[model samples]
Target: MRRLALPLAACLLLAGCAPTVSLTPAPQATAVGCASLIVGIRGIETIGDAQRRQTDAQGTAAWGTPASVTLYCGVETPEASALPCTTQSGVDWLLSESGDERIATTYGRAPGVQLITTRDASVNDALETLSGAVATSTRGTDRRCLADPGASATPSAIP
Candidate 1:
C-alpha cells in the first residue's frame, strides 16, 4: 500500500514539471508554419541558434514565392531554467511560431517566425509593406498587420 502511494506521488511530481508540450527531439523547425498571412509573421529579423540556419534560409527563400514560412530561435542553456532564463541570457533557446501565440501567451520560444506564400502583384513592388505588416502584427505593436492573420494567404491575382 505504501509503495503504491510512493509511485503515484512520483508520477504526479514529474507530470507537474513537464510543460503541456513535448520537450524531446529538440524541435527541428525546418520552417515556422502559419496558415493565415494577415496576422502571422513574414520573415525573421534575426535568429539565435546557428543550427537553424538551414530552416531560416528555407523561410527567407519563400519571399515573393508561393510559400508561407516561419522561423524560431532562442537560448536553451544548461546552467539555467527554460524561457524564464530571460531574453538576454546569452544562451540559445527554442524558437517557434506565433500561430499558437494568438491562443496562448505562454508558448514563448526563442524567436518563432510565420510567413504566408500567396499570389499578389504587390509582392514585387510592396515587399516591405507585406513583410512589415506581418512583423508588426505578430511581434510589433501594430494591429494593421493583425487585422486578418490569414489575409495574405489569398490566391494571387497575378494570373
Candidate 2:
C-alpha cells in the first residue's frame, strides 16, 4: 500500500506539470494560406517572458501559464472598420477591445492572423513578436488602415 501511494503521488505530480493549453481552432484553419502560417507560428521563440504552451489546435498557439496571449491563423481578413488600426514591424493590425481582452487581426493579409491578449502591454509585445511570422506567411493586399478615412482620396498605406 505504501509503494502504490508513492507511485500515485508521482503520477499526479507529473500530470500537473504537463504543459498544454486549450484553444479553439479558427473557423478557417484549413484555409489556403494556413499551412505556411502554421510553419511561421511554430518557429516563434518567445513572446515577452511568456513560455510557449502546447496547443491542440492545428493553426493556433498560446503562451504564458494562464495563456495571456493566443494566436489563431486563418481567420477571415477584416474589412475597413472604425476599429483603431496600427502597423507594427510592417504588419497592419486592426485593434478592438472587449472587457479586459484586446483583439488584433491582420488587416490587409489574407487568411488573417488574430491575436487575443489579456493585457495591453502583451498585445503590443505580441504584435511585434508575431509580425515577422505574419509578414512572411501571409499574402498582402493593397488594403491598408487610413488615419483619416474621409480626408484622403488616395489610400496611403500607414507607415
Candidate 3:
C-alpha cells in the first residue's frame, strides 16, 4: 500500500502541472480597442477550456482533444499584399496557408483577430460567433480581398 501511495501522489501532482496547449506568441501592438473582445465571445463548437498566454497576443481560444481549432485575438493587421479574402458572416477574412492549417484574419480591423485551425476543421461556425465581436472592436476600413466579378461573396470551407 505504501509503495502505491507514493506513485499515486506523484501522478496527481504532475497532472495538475501539465499544460493544455502550446501556443506560439504572435506579434502585438497596443490592442486598446480589442483587449477585452475575447471575454464577450464564446466558442461555437465543442472547444472548451480556452486560454491564451502569449505576451502580445491579446487572447486565444482552443478546442478539441488535441486542439484542432485555435483563435488568436489582437494580431497585427495583415498587409495589403496578402490577398484572396473571403467574406464570412459579414466579415472579410484574409486567408493564408500554413502546412495543414488554415489561417484567417479580418482584413480592415486594426489589431486583427486570427484563427488557426486544421484543414478539416470548420471555421464557419467560429466566424459566425466572432463576427459581431470583431465588428465592435475596431474601426472599419475599405481594404478587402478582391471578389471576382459576379462571383459569390460566400467562401467555401477551409480545406
Candidate 2, residue 34: Cα displacement in angstroms equals: 1.9
- Shift in Å, residue 105, candidate 2: 0.7
C-alpha RMSD for every candidate:
18.0, 6.6, 6.0
Instruction: Spell out the clash pairs found in candidate 2.
Output: none
- lDDT tens string, model 2, 68-151? 888998888766777677787777788777787888888898888898888623776787788887898788998998776444
Q: Could you tally the backbone clashes for each prediction?
A: 24, 0, 0
For lDDT, the strongest prediction is 2
Whose TM-score is higher: candidate 1's or candidate 2's? 2
**In model 3, which runs have C-alpha deviations exceeding 4 angstroms?**
1-19, 42-58, 149-157
Candidate with maximal TM-score: 2
lDDT of 3: 0.64
Candidate 1 lDDT tens digits, 14-49: 755523321221232332332232224334322221
- In the predicted model 3, the residue pairs found to clash are none
| CA lDDT of each prediction against the hidden true structure | 0.27, 0.77, 0.64
Candidate 3 clashes: the total is 0
